[model samples]
Target: MDKMDKDEPRWLNEAELNAWKAFNTLIIKLPAALDSQLRNNSGLSHFEYLVLAALSDAPQRALQMSTLAVLANGSLSRLSHVVKRLVKHGYVYRETAPGDGRCTLAVLTDQGYRKLAGSAPGHVEQVRSLVVDALEPEQIEQLRHISQQILHAMDPDLPCPDRR
Candidate 1:
């Protein structure tokens, strides 16, 4: 088998180029839109909302910081910084895991739960208005499949959140 020359790159063709452009635009714009909505309506960034929501879904409303990072799609360092902010807001607290002295856990306080509950409706409406309501039922399913394929290509072992 002959090796391909390094100078010959596999460039995207016309249709692929157009698709990439559209997808790239979406990737750039969607988060900004969501973050703007979240900031304006809930006083939270998208990542902060993700962290709170992840904790809210956990059993006992707590999770190990490392696990929380994965669920929130953030680095441990980034999670640590955000957690600090949340802690200062009286939204979340940190403690040692019950049986694991070396591991730390993040717990949602009652105030945190109420904040999440209050913020959820507006966030959900923003999501629905921006994405869900813009698609037909079949397109939504196709979007899911397409997203899963892309995610799998990025990291086969990445854990995606369960659909409601």
Candidate 2:
């Protein structure tokens, strides 16, 4: 074994470095790709689509703002900006929760539901074409598993449900 060099900073090994670079490339490129696809097909940004999708999955198509932020994989400040845009478009409505009036809820209006329903076909096709179709089923499963492992290592306390 080589002598330990105390003055040098520890860095990722080759495998680790390649993995990190690949993931970093994905983080940089995937959003722009998805946004372009969404905008071209639906006149909506990726962020807007995420907001609608989150609300559509909630009970009665409604979710608290804090919960929406987490589920949509966005910060509250970002969600606020998106919500304002959605509100102006008549796609969503925000109000105090019925049980706890202080808690804010973002409810998917009928317009929002329709818009998501319309965009989903194209979105699903884009996802399959870009991601799912590239992998065998086993590889897809491993990807999900590996992604979960890395996510857990990075965020030990975040409340993530099923990795899907």
Candidate 3:
């Protein structure tokens, strides 16, 4: 006999369930660990590091705040708050975009560039510690393919972040 719950879909198969549980657990745990590392060492959160890194990588070391919000997977309000903090910390400066006075650009300061450059190697090592070192090469490939397939179904128009 099959039991149905109003809010739940079909039961996940064993393999699917295992994968989902693994991903979910990793998602919750990895961020906390990374956030702790960043805060203790750099006086920044993981998301802040991400924002600075993304801007540092941009051509002019500047990006539209809306675009940055998408790249950071943060809401506009949330991004504004973080950007405010970054500006206060002397890491980022904001200015109105040339063509659109309404749109704001976050420009990474030289200090911010130095901060990202300093933090990145440690961050990469942390990522590797949690993920790459734990996975076999074949499993890594499987993860990449599975993630892309899920993302494609969810967002056909927007390419994956890694691709962008």
Candidate 4:
């Protein structure tokens, strides 16, 4: 709280630096690994898979575009582009929300559902292989706690799809 303390750069300590480096590496590598598995197995990017999965989890397999964006952790514009691609592939379609002309709803088509169903097993297996299987039960719980804490720190209002 002193002036000198405030002026000094608060750099990471040795332990903090090591933890950060390891976490940074995981951050860089995990997505690439997941994306590779998804692309190779299902011909979908990780973001695309997230979009489809979010829609598939929704009531009537449809959600408002804004809600979908939040659930997918993507920007509205990015969701729009991906939805357009899905539409072109006969996987999704957009329509004005019933009784709400201003809101656009993105609905997953039957084809999209089928694609997601087909993709889920492989994705789950890859996730298990890479993360779940690597951790003990206690560590899994710890990891969940740590992740939630970090996510809460990043965005206190972040909505969890499962909780919703």
Q: Which residue pairs show backbone clashes in model 3?
A: none
> Per-prediction RMSD in angstroms?
2.3, 2.7, 3.2, 2.2
Off by over 4 Å in 4: 160-164
Candidate 1, residue 138: the lDDT equals: 94
lDDT of 2 by residue, 51-118 (tens): 99989988899999999998888899999999999999999998999989889999999999999999
TM-score of every model versus the real structure: 0.93, 0.89, 0.87, 0.94
Deviation from truth (RMSD, Å), model 4: 2.2
Candidates' C-alpha lDDT: 0.93, 0.90, 0.89, 0.93
lDDT of 2: 0.90
Better of 1 and 3 by lDDT: 1
Question: How would you encode candidate 4's per-residue C-alpha lDDT over 46-137 as one tens digit per residue?
Answer: 99999999998999999999999998989999999999999999999999999999999999999999999999999999999999999997
Write the residue-wise lDDT of candidate 1 on 1-164 in tens digits: 34667667889999999999999999999999989988998898999999999999999999999999999989999999999999999999999999899999999999999989999999999889989999999999889888988887899888655522
Backbone clash count for every predicted candidate, in the order shown: 0, 0, 0, 0
For residues 25-111, write the lDDT of model 3, one tens digit per residue. Answer: 988998999998888778889999989988988989999999999888789899999999999999999999999999999999999
Tally clashes: model 4: 0
Ranking by TM-score: 4, 1, 2, 3
Q: List the residue pairs that clash in candidate 4.
A: none
